[model samples]
Target: MLLATSNHLGHDIRSEKYNVRGTKYRTKHFLEFCIFLFFIYEIEDNLIQNTR
Candidate 1:
């Protein structure tokens, strides 16, 4: 889910950046991406613990 969310967020960032509106959407997309990345890291940590 994290990977999928990252892909979606990347597409949103690209679309928002190219839009004629402004940087508002771009900033939102970037923040969302960061949050998703953190989620991915947490999942990885859990997986590592389970493997031990």
Candidate 2:
């Protein structure tokens, strides 16, 4: 199962960076990506514990 949903966020960032009408503020992507990786790690940990 896919965990990170960065595709839409990535598109938004690109659009904002390129388009004139969108906001150009940046910083959340890295934060969100880290959080997502954390969740994936937690899930994997739980699965490993359950299998033991």
Candidate 3:
């Protein structure tokens, strides 16, 4: 996948493939995307505790 920065804040990120499921994934930075993988699962682990 080619990651291109569309702006200075790295907010406008896009992938090469366009899924037809109507899911538009976006990210603020490439680094965030790297950590996002784990974050997807963290909701069940720490999200409940961190919500308070």
Best by lDDT: 1
lDDT measured at residue 4 in model 1 versus the true structure, 0 to 100: 100
lDDT of 2 by residue, 1-52 (tens): 1335587778878887677433232346667878999999999999999999
Runs in model 3 deviating more than 4 A are 1-28, 44-52
| CA lDDT for candidate 1 | 0.91
Stretches of model 2 off by over 4 angstroms after superposition = 1-25
Task: Name the candidate, 1 or 2, with the larger TM-score value.
Answer: 1
lDDT of each: 0.91, 0.75, 0.54
Question: Could you tell me which 10 consecutive residues in candidate 2 have the lowest summed lDDT?
Answer: 20-29
Error of 2 at 9 (Å): 32
TM-score of model 3 (CA atoms): 0.22
Task: Give the clash total for candidate 2.
Answer: 0
Predicted candidate 1 versus true structure: per-residue lDDT over 1-52, tens digit per residue: 9999999999999887778455777888999999999999999999999999
Worst 10 residues of 3 by lDDT: 12-21
Please, what is the TM-score per model? 0.57, 0.51, 0.22
Kindly report which residue stretches of model 1 are placed more than 4 angstroms away from their true locations once superposed: 1-21
Tens digit per residue, CA lDDT, model 3, 1-52? 2354345235423232344223443434556787887787787678778877
